[model samples]
Target: MQVLFGYNTNGGQSVQSYGYYDPNYANDIRTVMVAVVAQSHVQTPQQDAPTKLQLIPAVPASQSITGESLPAVYFYPPAGSHNAQFTVMTTTVPVMNMIWH
Candidate 1:
């Protein structure tokens, strides 16, 4: 197995993932993917809890796709998740060995 993709966020409020590809680019390969999420805890007095609630904000989510045939990966801020994705590593033949758009 070979590493083919990697992604991350600015802070721990989002998820991160890594992808592994197989040597056989012509056919599909099976592999397992995993993700771990961590959050911090703060201690505050009962009186301060109400006022401090506004300090925390809901995080926006994002998505990523490695290739057209691949599935989209959704990122939920703060907590992370994982999923399996199938991708093709082969390239199409080019007449001039180049691509335009």
Candidate 2:
């Protein structure tokens, strides 16, 4: 599986980060999971740890066709944050896991 990350800055005060996943298999996939963690890039260690951002599943399990080229899922992180990371994992099988920092 391959995961892609992007960000949009036009809507509000906070920047929005999006995650895209591609299983690259012909068969439909329903067990893929996407997660995002955002941390404020503060200069000091006293800052809080990364927070779990809310993920909005773009496609349902039934409609997650591999070749559609659209994002199987997407997420929006907290606004005005920095140092975002993304993780992709498969729940059903032992496929490779991915993490982006």
Candidate 3:
């Protein structure tokens, strides 16, 4: 039995994974790529059928911006008043998490 996993790093960084086969095995055989649907799917057995990639809704696609709309974030001066302290208002970004598995 073997367990394999992957994570990306820029080059020259430490490689971390747990498995038995040589990393070179990945190069000799054709790759089996499947669309990652969700975290729950990771534990699924892979032998039932052809290795498939399912595009599950991990994160909602951005429907709001589609060439005609402004981006979710923007910065500009405040309206209607001039200030003497000269400090610009700060902006905040919504926290985002991307699961690369």
Candidate 4:
């Protein structure tokens, strides 16, 4: 799993996600991509920007297919005034767990 964050040409935020796979595995190929956006609001002037990345693990009950452990990620803004966005991409056999900042 790999992630990248940067500013777009129009001064907006951009997120790029990439997944790596082993060459040995010819049939086992899968990718799970997750993105979370925290929209900025003008009415909430007192709201402080998040300083850290948050990763919330999925419980058994929250799993998409009964036993799968899907993750929920929160990627905050680079600057306080801009909206926050993040992308999570994974390509592994049986979908391995990924924890990154």
Candidate 5:
């Protein structure tokens, strides 16, 4: 797997980030597709619920889909009591691509 992902995990706040298509492009009208796979995962905290949280990739520096890389950014509400960590897997819109065509 590509090593575009990164993490800032620790004892208290476990954060996982991946590198792939940026989320800012999530609304890009001309956008075509996006994909990424989870390389690692941290155990979930016993106190926090597994809500629908996601490791959204930061906005592309220059919105370049070629050559340069896009890094993922973790964004969690609160661990509550325990620490919950997870890696980002494939993140793309295949169905969306169909519509584009």
Candidate 6:
């Protein structure tokens, strides 16, 4: 599995983003999980200090039969969720793991 990261600057708000993973083989199946965490200093006053990572939302999973390039799966941090960092974890069994930004 592979991961890519960038920012979306079209139209409205620009968002920090990342995506696109294709299995090694044409018939292979894989699942990708994505999450974002706010930088410590970005936490709001009402929010508790985050001691652990939090899940954002699931990126569209990928399945390809023709081995053709799969559609790009992109994820963005919530609006106003500033100073945020993103993570994408990929595994065969739908589990969360380490991903570098």
What overall lDDT goes with each candidate model? Answer: 0.27, 0.35, 0.24, 0.35, 0.37, 0.35
Considering lDDT, which of the candidate structures 3 and 4 is the better prediction for this target? 4
Runs off by more than 4 Å, candidate 5: 1-54, 64-73, 85-87, 96-98
- Cα error, residue 96 of model 6, in Å, equals 20
Better of 1 and 3 by lDDT: 1
Model 4 superposed RMSD (Cα): 14.4
With a 3 Å backbone cut-off (N, CA, C), the pairs that clash in candidate 3 are 34-53, 35-53
* Model 6 per-residue lDDT tens digits across residues 1-101: 23332223232222223244333221222233443333443555554432333343233333223223335544445566544443445432322223211
Q: List the lowest-lDDT window of 10 residues for candidate 5.
A: 6-15
* Candidate 4: worst-modelled 10 consecutive residues by lDDT: 4-13
List where candidate 1 sits over 4 angstroms from the true fold: 1-30, 42-68, 78-101
RMSD of 6: 14.1
Candidate 3 lDDT over residue span 1-79, tens digit each: 1122222232222232212234543322211222212212222243332232222212122311121222222223234
Tell me the TM-score of each prediction against the true structure. 0.19, 0.22, 0.15, 0.30, 0.27, 0.28
Comparing 2 and 4 on TM-score, the stronger one:
4
TM-score ranking of the models? 4, 6, 5, 2, 1, 3
lDDT minimum window of 10 residues, candidate 3: 58-67
Clashes of 4: 0
Model 2: weakest 10-residue lDDT segment is 92-101
Clashes of each: 1, 0, 2, 0, 6, 0
